[model samples]
Target: MRSVLAACLLLGLAHTARAEAPLTLRFVAPERYTDAQSRTGSGPTLRTTIGGLERIFRDLAGRTLHPGQSLTVDVLDVDLAGTDLPGAGPTAPRLVTDVTPPRLRLRYALRERGRVVLAAEETVTDINFLLRARPGGSSSLAYERDILAAWFGARIARREPPRG
Candidate 1:
C-alpha cells in the first residue's frame, strides 16, 4: 500500500511539472521575416538567429510566468538591432545607430489554468536601445534579448491586459 501511494504521488508531481511548462513558440513564415538573417556573409545564419530568439523567449517566459501560467507566441517578424554598413566587407560589423533599434512583431496569448487571460498582436521596439544599459553585454542576440525582456516585463510580468 505504501509503494502504491508513493507511485501515485510521483505521477501527480510529474503531471504538475508538465502543466507548468511556460512557453509555446511558433515562427510563422520564417522566410518572410524582416531581418532574421545575417547581414554579414560570415555571420550567423537565419536558422541561428531564429534559434537564439527561441531560447530567449523560453528563458524569459520560464522566469517570469506563474507556475500555472503559460504563454504562446507566434512570431511574425524580426528586425535586429542594427543595419549592416553599406559597402562593408563580409566580416564587417553591423552599424548600431539610434534609429536602428531592435523590433519584434508577434501575436501572443497568455493563459492561466487553460483560460486566456491576455492576448494581443504587438510590435515591440526600443528606439533608445543604444542609450540603455544592457545587462546581457556582448552576448549573442543581446540587443534583441533586451528588447524582448522589456516587452515581457511590461506585458506578462506585470499581468497587464493588452491595451487595445
Candidate 2:
C-alpha cells in the first residue's frame, strides 16, 4: 500500500509539473452585487435565477470569447432577507429548503468596477443584469454572452481591431 501511494503521489506531482497555468479571469468592477434567491427559501423573487442567468449568457455570447475583449453588465441592487448583512432579516442564513420560497429578488449593489475584481462582492448572487458598451459590430446579445462566460471563469474572447 505504501509503494502504491508513493507511485500515485509521484504521478500526481509529474502531472502537476506539466499542467498549464490557469487562465486568469478579471473582474474589473470595483463592486459586485451577488444575490442568491433560492426557489425554496425566504428570499424575494428575482427577474432571473442563477441557471437562467447562465443560460442567458450562453445564448447571448455563443460561448466562445477569445481574449482581451470585455463585456460590461449593469448589476441591479435590492434588499434581501436572510443575508449576512446587518438588519438582513428576522432570520438570517436561512436554509435552501425552508418553507420560505425564494422569489426573484435583487439583494445588493455593484456600484464600482474595482470592487468586482478586488472584492468578489457580487460573484455570489444569482441575478440578471444589463450591459453597456461603445459602438461595435458584435451586437449587445453576443457581447453579453461572452462577458457572462468570462465572469464564470471561462477564457476571454477578443476581436482584432481594424488596421490599414
Candidate 3:
C-alpha cells in the first residue's frame, strides 16, 4: 500500500510540473524598402520592420493566444511613401507630398491543431495620420507604426472572419 501511494504521488507531481506550450509566431517579409519616409522617421529601420512587427505581434499574442494556437504573417508588400500631391519649384516632383498616408499589405493565418482557423489578406491605410505630428520631426513611419499596432491589436482581439 505504501509503494502504491508513493507512485501515485509521484505521478501527480509529474503532471503538476508539466507546463503548457507557448504559441508560436512566424513573420515573413521578403521585400525591402530604402526610400520610405518611415525609414527616415524616428521608429526603426525599414530593413528591420519585420522584426518590429514580430515584436508587436508577440505582445498582442500574449493577450490573445490560447495554448496550441499559432500565427503566421506574410508581408507581401509595404508602401510607406503615402500619396504624393503636386508641389512647387524645380524640385516640385521630389517635394510634392503634403498629405501622404502609409499603406501595408499582408496575409496572415491563425492556426490551431494543424488547421487554419482564421486567415486573411489585409490592406491598411489612413490619411488622417498626416495631420498629426511627431514630437521632434516629420517621420510618417511613427504614425504608421501606431496605426499598425492598433489595427493588429483589434484584429487579434476580435479574431473575426476574413474580409476579402
- Candidate 3, residues 113-146, lDDT tens digits: the string is 6688778888766667645545654433465566
Off by over 4 Å in 3: 1-29, 32-45, 81-98, 130-141, 162-164
Per residue, candidate 2 scores C-alpha lDDT tens digits across 1-164 of 99999999999998765442122222223133344443444433343333344455444444442332324343343223233334455334433222222222212221122232211234222233223322453331233343344444421233222122
Clashes of 3: 0
The lDDT for every candidate, in the order shown, is 0.83, 0.35, 0.57
Pairs in steric clash, model 3: none
Tell me the lDDT of model 1 at 77.
Answer: 96
Steric clash pairs (candidate 1): none
**Runs of candidate 2 exceeding 4 Å displacement:** 1-9, 13-34, 38-147, 150-155, 159-164
TM-scores, one per candidate: 0.82, 0.22, 0.54
Best by the TM-score measure? 1
| Model 3 / residue 36 / CA error / Å | 5.0
Q: Which candidate ranks first by lDDT, i.e. highest?
A: 1
Model 1 TM-score? 0.82
RMSD of 2: 14.0
Clashes of each: 0, 34, 0
- Candidate 1 error regions (>4 Å): 1-18, 39-42, 86-92, 162-164
lDDT of 1 by residue, 1-164 (tens): 99999999999999987786778899999898888776556455689889999999998997899877889999999988787665566555567778888889999999888899889998888788877746548765888888889889989999776566
